[model samples]
Target: MDSDRIAEIIIAEIRSTVPELEAQPITRADSMADLGVDSIERSEVILATLEAIGLKVPMVQLHGPRNIGELADLLHAKSKA
Candidate 1:
């Protein structure tokens, strides 16, 4: 899927986990800080997203995309490539 669709899914996941958050688009470069997601939360997100995508990405690969938008972009690119 494209960025917008991917973003919606990511946002939903984040909202489900972080209920206190105001929903935002994961379609673009929204920072991790903007989502109120700290490192611990990101770890959970990493596992969940990987499982959803059916990919076993190395943790190092994930490290670069330190936010939902970046993560989504990375996943999309990886799938496309």
Candidate 2:
């Protein structure tokens, strides 16, 4: 999938999982914490995003993407693999 589509999915998941973040504008540079996602909510978002895209990423691999853009790139790469 393209990065834009991946970003859309991530944003959608964030909106669904984090109620307070629903009205905020999320961007590539924004970290999960910046969207008011605590560690636990971060995990929930990650898992939900993975499930939404039908991808199974290792937890270790998931640790590296600190921002939405990076996470989208990672998911795009994994989806291709």
Candidate 3:
């Protein structure tokens, strides 16, 4: 899938993992940290996103994205590989 779609998945996962943000608007430029998601919640979002995209990789390898867009881009690249 494309990065945009992956970003949507990430956003969905974020909303699902953190119900407090259900009414909040999420976009590609948003970061979980800035959204007030703790580290554990962030990991859960990422893992859930990965599962949604049928991706299996080391959690450490999924680091370095500063925002949802970057994470989607990285996940898209990895999925293509």
Candidate 4:
């Protein structure tokens, strides 16, 4: 239930799922548009991240986030709570 751990897992999952991201680190301020993350791809990343941590992420909550950083923050907060 740690924010930093969740962030780390998310970044790792993103890199694993999208091999093109092998060299870059996920950033909080980066937009999904800049990263070429479409809606479906974003969902894939989120789902992978949740699976990695043994969590069942709610699809309804997954609708709006655009990048791993924002999603990580939300998941981290939920974990903490």
Candidate 5:
């Protein structure tokens, strides 16, 4: 899947993991922390997203993304790898 699709899944997982964001508008540039998602909730979102995409890797490998878009791009690259 492309980055945009991965981003969609990420957004869905974020909404599912954080109900308060259900009504909030999320975008590629949005950061989970900026959206009031706690670290635990962020981890949950990431794990759920990884499951959705069927991509398994070390949690450390998923770090360094500055935003959802970057995360999507990273996941897309990793999935292809």
Candidate 6:
């Protein structure tokens, strides 16, 4: 999938996982913490996003993504792979 679509998916997952985030505009530069996503919420976001994209990225691999844009990029690369 394309990066923009991947981003949309990630954002949607975030909103679903953390309802408070639904009211705020998320940006590529915004870290999970910046958006009030705690550690547990972060994990939920990661798992949900991976599931949504139909990918099995290791949890360790997910550590590299600092924000939505980077996560989208990683998901895009993995989808292509």
Q: Each model's TM-score, in the order given?
A: 0.73, 0.91, 0.98, 0.74, 0.97, 0.91
Quality of model 4 by C-alpha lDDT: 0.69
Order of models, best lDDT first: 3, 5, 2, 6, 4, 1
Better of 3 and 4 by lDDT: 3
Put down candidate 4 lDDT per residue, 1-81, tens digits, no spaces.
676677787767667767888898567666555776666766777788778777765778656655556777788766555
Candidate 1 structure quality by residue, lDDT tens digits, 50-78: 67667676777767775667778887887
Give the per-residue lDDT digits (tens) of candidate 2, residues 1-81: 787788888889988988878888889889998777898988888888889889997866888888999989988888998
Stretches of candidate 1 off by over 4 Å are 22-27
In model 6, where do residues sit more than 4 Å from their true spots?
A: none
Worst 10-residue lDDT window, candidate 2: 57-66
Error of 4 at 58 (Å): 2.1
Segments in model 5 whose C-alpha atoms lie over 4 Å from true places: none
lDDT of 6 at 34: 83
Clashing pairs in 3: none
Worst 10 residues of 1 by lDDT: 22-31
lDDT of each: 0.68, 0.86, 0.95, 0.69, 0.95, 0.85
Q: Tens digits of per-residue lDDT for model 6 on 12-69?
A: 8889999977889887778888888899988998898888888986788768787889
Error of 3 at 7 (Å): 0.4
* RMSD, every candidate, angstroms: 2.4, 1.1, 0.5, 2.2, 0.5, 1.1
Task: Put down candidate 5 lDDT per residue, 3-65, tens digits, no spaces.
Answer: 999999999999999888899999999998999999999899999999999999998999999
Candidate 2 residue 33 Cα shift, in angstroms, is 1.3
What lDDT would candidate 3 get against the real structure?
A: 0.95
